[model samples]
Target: MTAPRATKTRTPKIRENLPAPQTAEGLFFHYTPEEAAQWTPFSARTLRDRIAAREIEYVFNGRDNYLTGAQILSLNERYTVKPFSKTHTRVAA
Candidate 1:
């Protein structure tokens, strides 16, 4: 008589509810407005304004818009710049 075969059970190791990065660059996640507000120094409204102004880059699916982590880095590059005041003006050579 042949021995009975054993059945195997598999279980997923990670939770499906956890957020995952969308891009291989690891710079983007799908975040709701509230989540973005807490993570970003800029308020949701201000972020929206910047988006409208094209000072920053973002992606929008039909339902929601998100700024990639790369976008955040880009913002840090240019957003902190202060305008040149008269006191700091350079004289023509």
Candidate 2:
């Protein structure tokens, strides 16, 4: 009897919307879910969940939702932990 061949499973490619080149200085661009995922460790679905739960702020440009770089940075900052300082000594009661 012939051995059955194993089929290869492929992951679907995520389509991302690239931001346009800045026409003026100091102007920022918005990112799609896929693009935002590239900047953060969370997946696109997580981002969407965050948006739905109002955990993160987002902008709706008439038809589509977008996130700004500042917003992503703010989200990251919210989860960042500050290191504990070990300079002070405990006082005896």
By TM-score, the best candidate is 2
Off by over 4 Å in 2: 1-27, 90-93
Candidate 2, lDDT over the whole model = 0.70
* Candidate 1: segments with Cα more than 4 A from true spot: 1-26, 81-93
Error of 2 at 81 (Å): 2.1
Instruction: TM-score for candidate 2, please give it.
Output: 0.62
Best by lDDT: 2
Model 1, residue 82: distance off in Å is 9.0
For candidate 1, lDDT tens digit of each residue in 1-93?
Answer: 998887877532332342433345537655543445544668877887876787777888876667766666566566677778666677999
Instruction: Look at candidate 1 and give me any clashing residue pairs.
Output: 27-69
- Per-residue lDDT, model 2, residue 15, is 51
lDDT of 2 by residue, 16-55 (tens): 4554323232025677766777767688889988887888
